[model samples]
Target: MWPQEVLALSRRWLLVTLRERLNLLFSVLQPAVWLVFFAGAMGGAVDSRVVGTGDYIAFAVPGVIAFTVVGNGVTAAMPLLFDKETGYLDKLLSMPIRRSSLIVSRFVFQTVMNAAQVLVILLVALALGVRPASGAAGMLVILVATGLLTLALTAAAMALACAVPSHGTFFAITGFASLPLLFMSNAFVPLSAMPGWMEAVARVNPLTHAIEAMRLLVLHGWSGGVPASLGVLVLAASLLLVLGSWQFARQTAERIA
Candidate 1:
């Protein structure tokens, strides 16, 4: 029953996203632009000695992949906000479906969308001569890391959506949060390149771990920290999912009250 409900809801959301052609185009395009322009422009300026590789494209690919997760995950809650405004969320809650289905379905849909975007980014990077050192296995690890990170972020977004009073506030908060997180992490630059304070902060950033795991896979194949990085992501995702589910139920209860 749970699986059926989740699948039905996920399918609906997926179709809605697909039908928005411009959204799909920009979703891929934003990251592609970063990969091409930002990476290209800055690649030359970066000292190859810092990253231990001459190819700045390769160094930056993991960061771009992480950026894709951040970009997609932060916006995952917009649909929920729209539904809330339209009262569709209330109507759905009135149905006999499991309450948890709402959150699960969103997570599933966002995970798929984020994965697709990441795949497109990787393919484009490959076309431009970037190859993962671990080959297919490395790519699989990247996808797994991406999935876990997206799940955590998507769940966080859903919780924010339920907590916030309006779509405008949600957008403002997410936008505020995303950029700092991106720049502070090792996504675009090595920790060695950052000042002491920023490096310390980046060390604690979850995105840093995820990006490092991916960098290790892409640049050096499997390594020691891969398991730890992935484990942290899985744990984070589980906790966030539970929190998001709780918030979702609370929101529904408030609607009924």
Candidate 2:
């Protein structure tokens, strides 16, 4: 019953998102724009010693994909926050369905949506001459790492949405966090290129770990770093999922009480 409810709710959210065609278009286009323009503009100026590749686009493909994942995952709270504003969340709390299903379904929906968007980004990268060095197997590993990161981020976002009182507050917090998180990571530049302080921060940034894992798979194929990077992401996903689930359960229990 719980599984069935989660599936149905996830399907409903997927359909709702698909119907918002412009939203979907902009979501894809935002990252695509960064991939093409940002990578193009910065590619020539960057030293090969810093990026470890003459082709910045190839190097940036993973970074831009990570950007897309983080953007989508962190902003995954908007819909639920909007529902709160609309009184829909209160209504949901009163439903016959398991309360846990509401949170799980959102996670499912965002994961699916993020994966689709990432696929389109990969296709665009391919058309632009960015080939994965690790082949199909490497691509699979990239997506797996990406999905783990998504789970961790979406869990955190959803927990924030529930805790915050308004969507505007949520927007402000997420918007403020996104750029710092991106710039601090090896998203556009490698850690070797960063200053000592920034490099220390990037080393601890989950986005950096996730990007490095995917970047390794995309550019270098199999490597020792891939497993370590994936390990970091797995730990992040597991910890955040547990914490987020607790937040959801507590919130729902209070609402019902």
Highest lDDT, which number?
1
* Error at 186, model 2, angstroms: 0.9
Q: What is the TM-score of each candidate against the true structure?
A: 0.95, 0.95
lDDT per residue for candidate 1 within 157-190, as digits (tens), equals: 8899999999889989998999999899999888
What tens digits encode model 2's per-residue C-alpha lDDT throughout 124-161?
Answer: 88889988888988888887888898999999988888
Model 1 regions lying over 4 Å from their true place: none
The TM-score, computed over Cα atoms with residue i paired to residue i, of candidate 2 is 0.95
lDDT to native, each model? 0.88, 0.86
Task: Show pairs that collide, candidate 1.
Answer: none
Evaluate model 2: give its lDDT.
Answer: 0.86
Output the lDDT of residue 189, model 2: 91
